[model samples]
Target chain A: MPDKRCTEDEVVAELADGMTIGIGGWGSRRKPMSLVRAVARSSLRDLEVVSYGGPDVGLLCATGKVRRVVYAFCSLDSIALEPHFRRARQDGTVETFELDEGMMLLGLQAAAWRVPFLPTRVGLGSDVLEHQRDRIRTVRSPYDDGEELVAVPALPLDVALVHLHRADAAGNGQYLNVDPYFDDLFCRAAARTFLSVERVCPTEELASNGPLQSMLISRLWVDGVVEAPFGAHFTECVPDYPRDEEFQRAYAAAARDDEAWAAWRARYLDCGGHDAYRDAAGLR
Target chain B: MSGPAASVGPGPATRADHCVVALAECFRGDGEILANPIGTVPMIAGRLARASFEPDLVMTDGEARLVAGPVPVGVEAPDVIVEAWNPYRTMFDVVWSGRRHVVMGASQLDPFGNHNFAFIGDRRRPRAQLLGFRGAPGNTVNHATTYWVPDHSPRVFVPAVDVVCGIGTDRARALGPSGRFFELRAVVTNLGVLDTSGPDGRLRLRAVHPGVAPEDVQAATGFLLPMVDDLEVTRPPSAAERVLLARIDPLGLREREVRTS
Candidate 1:
């Protein structure tokens, strides 16, 4: 097997403009913040981000990198709403395809299964159908039942960025936390996938680190691996550390105004690289 | 009846305690189903239900595990007995199975029980941007759904929701057999307990908290709420229930979430 280890910048370098990028993690937990920071600092434009969004979507929207967002919700968990993403939506900065959470999951699953769409009854009577009428279509069952269900289209992505607790140079990733979210699905649904991990362990150690079920991402689906410690900073990585509530509060506070955002961007986002961002944010 | 009534035991039951018990009563018969409560009071209510009356109800640790026991609220690392691992992905299996009863918060709720937490004004650009159309669309359509509104005001109890994130009685009825599993169980607010159990399937004043008159609830609502003929006061937490509430919420986080004043 090839050693697919790369830098966060290298992962960002592989991404192109107008690409659909699937971000892993569910609402501010286990996000690839290092890689997301690299994307924020990069000149990538007109990107469509699909996520169970948190600050990843917020940062992308704040940096003017996103042209569209396909999401169920963009929340900070503890913080009810993500401020930057809220501002972006309020300003009509990006086009949105807001689906039911289950619909989004089915879409990703459809892509991973190499199917055009997966039929479900999630968005039947909600405004989701009205909002996403252009993209989502209904299909009647071919069987005797003839029940109509929402055909959640494949959410195929150009690239996927995920953060895991540990990974091998061969690109197999494992999550130490209880919930793996949808990182594996994101990786399989994307054409290319990059994983950033807290540590790069030997392939054998990956199995020993945790249960076999924790090994979520297979090397077959991953294109690159970046060993960026605290890669999921500000987000909870469980046994390693919890979410930096204070830092997240500061981030949310900055999004209140352009000047505050600019100051925060300079102090954090534009500060050279991931290591510098950590140092500036006082993350030891 | 006046609002501040004495409880069966312990201290006088605050309005928050009444709301908690009312919210807990929402899951009284939801045996063995997953009780996924979203907000603070709802969380307390879910645990309260599980700890006391509805012991068969499944509860999570507010993260990923199906906890066998009621984990204390606001405790960083409470001793939890893990029954099963329920990741976000795996949760869909439970959600779609119609085996879950969720008590979620609503930014805007209408007489028909349609909820809107997506956006306020318009789809293109709204006045306020709340949590988008999350699991509301799916949850409402799939299983038993309830709403826990900590604040019951004209703003929340709207005439009609701006966006229907959760399918109401009207929309669900339109789906025919597709909406077979849809059940808008109840809506528990700070002021009173409301339900869409009327013949027309519209929100009706089921019961008011102690001191809160049915007229007061209707006055605070954006539209006139139909009153149940036998409207009664919401049950206050008993001394045993209060002890359980304290055990579940040792930090008194429920008080912070709901303010009677």
Candidate 2:
């Protein structure tokens, strides 16, 4: 087995400027914040981020790292609108490819399965056809000549980042929570996969303790595994911690003001990695 | 009816409570359906509805688990009864099967009940990127859908949406039989409740909030709303509904979203 265990820096080093990155998490839940922070701090620019967005999108947008964002939603769950993403959009800082949640999934699915395009009826009458007309096309079904479907093209990604509850040294991920989001699809779709977990346990522990169905990602797919305890900070990694609402609120408030965000970023995110963030935020 | 006056309408509850009650009322007749409320206020309404009269309404724990009882919003409850495991994929199954009823937020809602929370300005190069059309298209086309707008203004209640996330009466009609399952149920705003009625099936004044007048709703709306001859005042929560809402939302977080002023 290839030694998948590596440092967070090694994972970030794999990324380059202007790459199409698929981030796994549903909005503010189980986001790979460690990798996200690494990217934010890096010199990487003009990156295209694909995510069921949360703070990761906001952070990248706020830092001017992202050239385009493809998302179903960008709200911070309870906070409603992700302030940074909203501001970025309103200010015309970043471009976006808006897809219906299902269509977004289909796009990932097409890439994962190595298909050119997948047909769907989701965005038939809606303006998604109007907006993403370049990427999507109206096609008549072969089975029934008159039956029309939307051909959603594949969103081939350069890298995929995901945070899970736990993983083994070989990178077999275990999500003890309710949903796995689209981590598996993301891993399959991306050229490279970086798996960050709250803890890295022995392979035997993963077999004995983890739920059979929640074991979404196989080690064969994971290129690197970085042990990032509390990695999905501010976002909920269920069975670990609830979402840090106070910090999320503070982040939102700070996002409204450049000075406040600067001070907040300097004190927390700019300090160091996850441990430094923890210490600075008085987390532990 | 000699009872505690505080238990029912005209009670000490804020406008938020009344707004929640109105939103909950939208799901009153909807029995044994999946209540997928995307935002905080809508989630409150769904949970409140489930806890009260609409007992059979199923709710996701905002993660993936289907809960047997109402789990408080944003609070991590320790002993939540996990009735079933509802993964993200299974959610799509529920959506496709016409089994779910979602109460979604709207950045812009038109006279035909079309909603947009996706993008603003030109389609090719949008001036602003809102949420990508997240499940709104499928949800509106698949099953029943209701909208909740915290701020009722001419901006939200627009003449035409910049982007159509959810199909309205006009588009549904254009689709003919393919749009058979489309049910744009109601629009619950801070000011009042709007629904489709009359011969044309356009947005109509269902009921105005207690302090809100018909003229107030008309003035706030960018498009002309067909008002009912006998416009009823939105009902305040009954004693039972109030008690249920209190249990679901003990922190009174609903008030913060729906302003009394």
Worst 10-residue lDDT window for candidate 2 chain B reads B1-10
lDDT of 2 by residue, A1-284 (tens): 56699877888888898999999998889999988998998889999999999999999999999999998889898887788998888777888787889888889999999998898768878988766777779777777546677788899999999999888888899998878889999999999999999989887788676668767889978999999888999898878998999989998998878999898889877998878887887776
Q: Which CAPRI quality tier does the interface of model 2 achieve?
A: medium
Please give the lDDT score at residue B106 for candidate 2: 90
For candidate 2, the per-residue lDDT at B218 reads: 92
Clashing pairs in 2: none
How close to the true structure is residue B254 of candidate 2, measured as C-alpha lDDT?
82
Give the distance in Å from residue B79's predicted Cα in candidate 2 to where it truly belongs.
5.2
Highest-scoring model, TM-score: 1
* lDDT (tens digit, per residue) of candidate 2 on B1-261: 222322345556667877888888888888987888877788888898888889999888876789988777766778899889888888988998999999998999988898898878875456776776889988888899999999999999999899899989888888776678899889998898888994467999988888888999999999888888889887777777776766677666787788877
